[model samples]
Target chain A: MTPEQEKEKEEKGEQEEQVLVLDAMKRYRNGEIWDFEDDMAVSDGHGGGENGVLLGLDGGTTSTVCICLPMVPSFSHSQLQSLPILARAVAGCSNHNSVGEIAARETLEQVMADALSKCGSKRSSVRAVCLAVSGVNHPTDQQRILNWLRDIFPSHVKLYVRNDAVAALASGTMGRLHGCVLIAGTGTIAYGFTEDGKEARAAGAGPVLGDWGSGYGIAAQALTAVVKAHDGRGPSTRLTNSILQALGLSSAEELIGWTYADPSWARIAALVPLVVSCAEAGDEVANKILLESVQELASSVKAVVERLGLSGQDGKDAFPLVMVGGVLEANRRWDIGKEVVNCISKYFPRVLPIRPKVEPAVGAAWLAWNFFMKECYS
Target chain B: MTPEQEKEKEEKGEQEEQVLVLDAMKRYRNGEIWDFEDDMAVSDGHGGGENGVLLGLDGGTTSTVCICLPMVPSFSHSQLQSLPILARAVAGCSNHNSVGEIAARETLEQVMADALSKCGSKRSSVRAVCLAVSGVNHPTDQQRILNWLRDIFPSHVKLYVRNDAVAALASGTMGRLHGCVLIAGTGTIAYGFTEDGKEARAAGAGPVLGDWGSGYGIAAQALTAVVKAHDGRGPSTRLTNSILQALGLSSAEELIGWTYADPSWARIAALVPLVVSCAEAGDEVANKILLESVQELASSVKAVVERLGLSGQDGKDAFPLVMVGGVLEANRRWDIGKEVVNCISKYFPRVLPIRPKVEPAVGAAWLAWNFFMKECYS
Candidate 1:
């Protein structure tokens, strides 16, 4: 073999060794292996209220929140919307899959107790609770969350649970109880039910795989642009200074350390505001990133609309499209919202767009109220 | 403020907290913070060879290799080429900055001993040793490496050390080392010396900030594409399956876990081969990725060439551009080499591309030779 080929063959050996060496680094010189800590949140059950209210909890990757609403046995959808929210509470991350079971349980309990306290209600006053959590994608994941909730609340308290996407849809509909919700928080996804009760979704592949048009996606693009500019591989952008200042770092080099130091998807996603601010300041790179995100999200709406067959026919009602999450909700000034609306309108001219009338937690409570309310009317 | 603004303000609080929390995590959970271990490599002192041969060590972010070259008292530039290479050795990672210092010392010792064994060279007979290590970016980083090396070798042994990029440049030009070397391994950079000895560099920034057209850059793009395809935000490709198979993982979801599990830059960079193979197989996504990488690399070369004023003039010598690292050097069948050559030639047609005539270790030795040879001549 030529010397070049021999050199290549030898280099190949080292690449293989490099991978094996990493596996050996499984344990560090530091003997401290962190166990999943259970004391993730604080809980205080100190309040009193009237009986027969249903509680709704929205537990997500970063935080958990709960809202309490009075359940009227004979209420219409309109009355359900007008019902007063007794209390609300928020706490730390409760993504069981990502953060571990004990941590999730502790955070959920904290939020639940805080919500019940704010309502001046004892645990016994709550008639039922519905928890719509992020990361409840599979049936097994859903069951695991239900099991955790069951262990906390009294056995007699009725409970319901689903993916947080369901809460997003319910919140925007205001108990109308049908149609699609497009969420673009740190991640992005479009999910909805057709009038025929069939469900469809697009995107939502999570941080590493998908999350197009999401907060993380925007931040990632901004980072790439900044790096490219720094390398002279791409055009210049204001994202570099904005991102560094936002992170309170001094230089692009420090930004690398900060990014990899934790490398949490949510933490990176939080930088979306920095990008948005840059776009607002007329940074060409930031504007391009935002436009691309809007386009991707619009395409998601198109896919879900096609998949669920939610297009409005002649004389039929337009498909309702509820926009949620930080990216979509914050897009009014930047016109990301307007662009998405325009792009999706090309496919479904009469598609109705709605923002949530109540908090997602309150919507979850409304769904819980509807569960037994429907039974009473039947 | 609007509720959305309030939410944004509240999220701002969390982002600040996230930054602080990361700072707190700077302390490793393992209390046994590693110090540079001195005795990592076993010193057999077993081999003996003719006196006055210089030793060269090229220690990179990956494996470390060593070369031994004979030094003649009255050798000219042409005569230096005729000297036989006395020995060679290869060992695992010796990058004190990226890998811990202990791992660095251990691998260096192993390669040193193995090379000496091959050359039958005793420590007393070797005239001098030059080490060009990856991650010697700053004086402090360089001092750390020197301090570690000081502990390993006797004080009487003459020594020199610098970043591996220097060795890469020297390897291509032999002893007449002037002009830029463009590298696109797991990382990327352009470094060069003018005839008068002034030095300049471009695009050596690490993965997050720059390293344009590097293996890590291509891998990151491939990863983003795979995710986009999976989510329907982009066209479907064979990358998802190929990447999963290459990593020996089952699902795309598992990739998030695997990626962040250790998240070493080289580990991710190692996946570039998979992308190249896919591109070779006519995967459109992979081909696009390759083209972008080549373009970025070309831009880096352009920046460095312009910075150093290495552009060819009517009466001046043709500027030499050395191509180094796995991504450039391994492109026999794939044509990444041809693409880079074509791209750079567009900017300066007289630019010369030279592959390394000697291993980087041999170049390091040549540098050591030049150090004393010039001293003797002067």
Candidate 2:
């Protein structure tokens, strides 16, 4: 197809996606999605202090971050912008999918206690709590989390729980709550909604089924390459020496024992930079790993865009492509982001992927603000 | 390099390797290596009854096999050939690298008890007990194993401990106490000795550091390819469907959870037939996986042959390339054995690879016989 025809086709698809989002928004406002007042108490605006605060948490596969900040009313854009981060704390992984229930609970509670301690806010003073966890993809997941987290706050504090992708998208679009969020950290998943409320996801099944372009995925590849070289089944690469040294492992044999014994996704993810450096130093295997990773991430973004019928949208008309997670962040120095840009450019030339302006905890705060403000306005 | 030149170079390398093995053997026989009647107790020729028996155990990464038989003396080669397997029992993994110490010992004990029950013999009736496990490579490992096994055997029973590779070599050569054994079971490792008694190994570190062409290795490759296909980073393969189905997992994502929860190298290796079938059905990825696996096994076999200076030895003089393990057995139908033979033909045209005629446990029994006979003659 000619570029002109392709552009026209893309515009039509974007128009369709916008319509889907709008329809979903109408359904949501009509009380057709996500809640009931008895199970989840939302916007019971009467109880919180005058300077009502919302605790926002972004719980990732490998780590969790919590931020306490004052929540403002719906109409105040400047208030949303200037809202101070009262306290911020980071903790180890709390995702139930990755860590067991007890570990996840401990990490979450630790971060919550730390944040509350820093902010000096009593349970009564807290107005709302929003936790964006990577595995909170279903209503059942959210409800389980709500029950678990109820002990951390006063009975009246409105609780919001959603997957981290929601906070990620909110972060890039300033809490508009629609558009794509592509995550390539310890795990990889792309999720988003059109303005019309049509939500979709691509990838994010984790390392077993999917999780392409994730740090774990990259590390797995580097390991496979190293072993193949050792067995004389694959080409030689400098990754053999660098990966072992970077991980502080004496021999490659120790990795299985270490991984299975403790099971740390974050530690494996931490090896991405070493791979990136090797790629930069012209190691073919490393370069191949990066290229494949780039393709996986781009494909994830494209999957969401296509599912939302927003493929080939013009740069101006395209949904904001929010990129988050350590893998994407690590590549900021390796020209990989540019490579990512180029791969997705065919389907999204008018769009550009950018990291969140604020930390993910702050992004969760923005999601809380958006949730409450939408309630007040509706 | 030309084939003739390559052959010549391989011969020289083999000569060097053979010399090294001879030197090590000399040192061992001179009481300069391993131990002197401490951790390992060789047959003192003064144990139990006149019709004393031996218990041989082959402890693999995933499975354990125990066989009990009468130990005929040095002059009874005919008796050795006709000796029946009195009892045999299979148990769970006894590899310390894969399972913890307690689990390994429990498995060993369980299998031992089961075999003894079937044979209708008391622990005292067993004059010698020899166990060969895959992961017990170092002298320290052997020492630890010796200490662990002593509690299971009667005080009068002579106990010998060595790695499983020794038993594999023994099985192929009918207890020759020399030549190479190639194991491609749940884990991969090629081990052999020169005629002069120099022992060496290539690969077999387990899935983390080595074990290429192992069942675990093949499974890892299959998983990687499937996920890559799902994400469009690799070609599509029948493996994507076959592997999931074989594991009773609906999606690839569940494999990570399945693997981490149970962590069975043998379970993963069990997928080898499915991969082989897919390759037979013309799945490019599956075919590629098999081809690579074939080459790795060949390379492993070649490593041992060269080290023992048996590279070009023909007929009876050639080092027996003993192929053991689930993988080698599985390939009997796939002509993978033929493929393997072809790969190694250049270096060892006169020698051929063969599966053991007897069970690996029987090989352990043979090792016990050799140990006792060596004591009697020396």
Which candidate number would show the highest DockQ if scored against the true structure? 1
Highest TM-score model number: 1
Query: Which CAPRI quality tier does the interface of model 1 achieve?
Result: incorrect
Estimate the TM-score of every prediction: 0.78, 0.70
lDDT of 1 by residue, B153-239 (tens): 666666777888888887877755688898888888888788877776767766645464898888877887876665455677888
- Candidate 2's residue-wise lDDT over A28-95, tens digit each? 34433212223323344222237577888989866899988876674475457677788898999988
The DockQ figures for the candidates are: 0.16, 0.06
Q: RMSD of model 2, in Å?
A: 19.1
Which residue pairs come into collision in candidate 1?
A: A30-B30, A48-A120, A48-A121, A49-A120, A49-A121, A209-B227, B48-B120
